[model samples]
Target chain A: MHWKEDSAEEGDLLRNALAGCEKAWADLFRMHYHRVYAFAFRSGLSAEDAEDAAQEVFVKAARYLETFKGDSAFKNWLYGIAHHAVMDLLRKRGRREVLLERLHENDTTSKCSAAAKHTEVGDVLGQLPDDLRMAVVLIYYEGKTHKEASKIMDCAETTVSWRIYIAKKRLRKLLEKRG
Target chain B: MKDDPIEKYLVKLEVPTPQQEAVERALHRSTLAFKNRVEPKITQRENTVFKWFEKYYLAVAFAIVFAAFASFFPWAERVCPAASETSDLLAIYSEVKMLFQNNLVAVLLQGSELKVQLGVPRNVAGARVMFVEFSRGDEKIKVLCLEGSALRVPLQGKVQPVLEAMPTADGGVILMGDSFVWSRAMPQTINGYNISARLL
Candidate 1:
């Protein structure tokens, strides 16, 4: 499902959630769970780990709802939380190299065309460092501008631009080698 | 940008959607966790006290350290030596006057003791040092009441006189001779001045 940026609706849901409305919290969780999951997955987490990371993001958002002063879009704020949650899970599990190996093995073995392509993409992303991979995923897969990607990744715009440039160069080299 | 092959692959990458049942389960868990969360209720008075400590914690810590050092170490009292020494001198004078009025001379002059005299006060390291003399024939026992400062006892004669110094509670010292029998009237000195004694 395509999730549009609706600040007014999100603000109302957030206010009701803060006012102890459980249904409002559930609504907010359902609305953003898919995008958070997809973000985690495209950021080099396994499907199961992405699900866990998404759940963690919503729980944290609910916990720190008051700190959101509506300075930026709630989507950006939620993506910020998602970014940290995914990175923390990655760091704690120490499975980046292992996941890369697994993705390469799946890319070579998978017979289905769509699954092969998806695994190939994951394998290529897994080759980039965590920061550069996040830059590529946020810009290309998530369709965020450099400004929004910088905010989500907690870096300067120039840094994001630099990372994307380096990441694209390396990805082209990697894809050419595969071809 | 639109014709870029790498961007095209990344944009077309398909991420597996989480099952609807898993989403519902996660929502229920998050809702339960949110409802179970208890924010601490801070009263206005408690908040004010917290903010007060936050603001003046450095000054309060400094005062506590100063007070602790002053109580533990005698030399820290040198910071205000004049006031302490003066009060100690007054206490010693009042005790000596009471001893003289009671005709305690006979008890003090048990053997060859003739008389006792309070000498003039002298300044030593910003503290007043008073001398009490107990005379017996040609021999005299001198007691030095040194207060507020850690100054060495002043000895006028070449003789060492066998000095003994006892520390009082308020950072003062009582120095006396070994030959004399010191009948300690008050064992514990209050405000650093309890030197009421008769020499035998």
Candidate 2:
């Protein structure tokens, strides 16, 4: 479901959670956990790393709850935090080079199994630069609009469009070379 | 418009789903963290105070150093011998510092008219005092004034001589310095022996 449709319910859950309601906290966590996990994964983290990133995002959100000004949707604010958390995880692991090497290796191998295809796609995404990767992940994989993705990425909406343009061009070249 | 080939390809590609047990584990850990959340209002207040300190620490340090230097070797003492009466001069300097601290200097400087008065206390013989009053809009402030004779004292300290004292036609003197001017005149007595004094 779109975040807008559930925004009022989510806001109530967030308010209750902040008010120390355990059930509300559980409900809020269950609501966004998968999406945040998927965001982390699509942002070039491994499954385990994504889980760690998601956990860190929620912890940080709780810790800095007062900083949430309600200027933006809660989901976008959460995604902004998620963006930083995922980037920090990736930087800490120094996984870009490894992912690139895996991408090159997978390009030469047969695209047979579903698991292999999944890893190949992730590796291909990881091969893109961090900014371009984020643009693609937020706009394409996560189905965020340019405006919403700009909020998540903390950049101008035009910058988001430009980054997506560059990312798609790069991805096209990479895929064509692989074929 | 038809979907781009790349978009079609990416959309069709199945991303791996997170394992159910892993999601449960993350939820458990996150909920525990959420339950034990720190009080954000306290954290935000502390952060604001720290930010304020970070921004003004240098200015605050300089103000401290200036205050210490001014107290030890006051500007009044360097300009005039009568100002060597450090106790009285320092008291006036302390008053000036209070005015500065309370952001009253601007108001005093920009006051509409300058009124000067001189009086001697009934009990204190040979001790003359001057009152300088300033009015800004409806606000009135009166500051203790020092004599031009005080500024005529020979320079004795390493401090640069900056004060200019101009005597007025009516036996009043105007003492001009870097940022302020103080005007004073001879004592004015109301009754033959009863000279009322107003101390700030």
Candidate 3:
């Protein structure tokens, strides 16, 4: 209920912000800062970098309010921005290097997944390949209907079904391997 | 895959440490903060993909712009343009086109006429941002609350008499006989089958 209200309010704030309403920008800040922050953190940036990236995301978002599209929900749209900002930050570090790091990064799988639905999971879930990872994130963590996930992923429901099958098997395998 | 029991036990976690409420509140605060600073164009897990670009932003931007310009010149199209153009080569061009092409939504600038805007902007944010107005036609009924491009959110209800939208600068679009310029689209935000009108 709160999230729905919060998003709806954020929608209004975004609308107001575009119209140059004074409180609107403040309201936007109050609403999405930490989600952006957590998003940055979960994407593999250090705390300081996450903070900087979060700030970067908002700054860009505010500057481009004129381009806001109500197409997807406001929140999904914003995630797209934060995703870019985080990517930009990491890209600044270089793609080959980042991938090499991920390929070689020490395991942190022991960390329990966040109880909070939207935290690092956004990063982790998105971290996976479109097939195995996306399904795991949506079904296992996000608790979305496979049907809904299929819509977002633009895959056939059966593909989602198969992906989820492989994803869970892989996840359990990963967890056991990690343990 | 359907009968897989592990799917049942996968585990459903809440948003965070406190409650979904606390995390939501924190996220909301973060959104406000983030928006106060910079409002970027697109945010998606693909953003991480962009991080790969940042390392070579200038190079990438240069490559993209150069490529766009090259592609736009219809140079390759003029050449061999036939069936054997080059498989991998054309594929790259298609991928590049997708970047700037469909992101736009349509706007009817004048009566019985329309324009395709390249980007989404404040002028049309939260308005219908789709080719077919993603929602049903339920939002066009009794509430006519906009003047030119300005919105009266508080007074938004059912649109009566089916008010017409004016041409405005927004995300940016390509109109007939018009060169590239940033312009806004009308508020047809939720282009659903049933959205004849909207609440806000």
Per-model tally of clashing residue pairs = 0, 0, 97
Distance (Å) between predicted and true CA of B11, model 1? 1.9
Worst 10 residues of 2 chain A by lDDT: A104-113
Which digits, one per residue and each the tens of the lDDT, describe model 1 over residues A72-171?
A: 7777888999999999988977666547654764656542246777777777888888999999888987889999999999999999999999999999
The local lDDT score (0 to 100) that residue B102 gets in candidate 1 is 29
In terms of lDDT, model 1 sits at 0.68
* lDDT for each residue of candidate 3 in B1-200, tens digit (9 for 90 to 100): 44554443343322222234544544455445545644454577767778778778888889888888887785657666433523433343345436555443223222233333343323444453211122333332222222222221211334312223333354332111122121233233321222222212
**What's candidate 1's DockQ score?**
0.30
Task: Report model 3's TM-score to 2 decimal places.
Answer: 0.37
lDDT of 2 by residue, B103-170 (tens): 22211221454322222212323323343333434544434433331221112234332333444566
DockQ order of candidates, best first?
A: 2, 1, 3
Model 2, span A59-130: residue lDDT tens:
787767656777777778889999999888888888765476445535564432465766767767777888
The regions of model 1 sitting more than 4 angstroms off are A1-7, A97-113, B37-200
DockQ, Cα level, model 3: 0.09
TM-score of chain A of 3: 0.59
Ranking by lDDT: 1, 2, 3
> How would you encode candidate 1's per-residue C-alpha lDDT over B1-200 as one tens digit per residue?
87999888786567876767767777877887788755545556798889889899999999999888788886865678757655664565446656664222111221353244333323345433444444434444444343322222233444434333444455434544544323243344222223343211
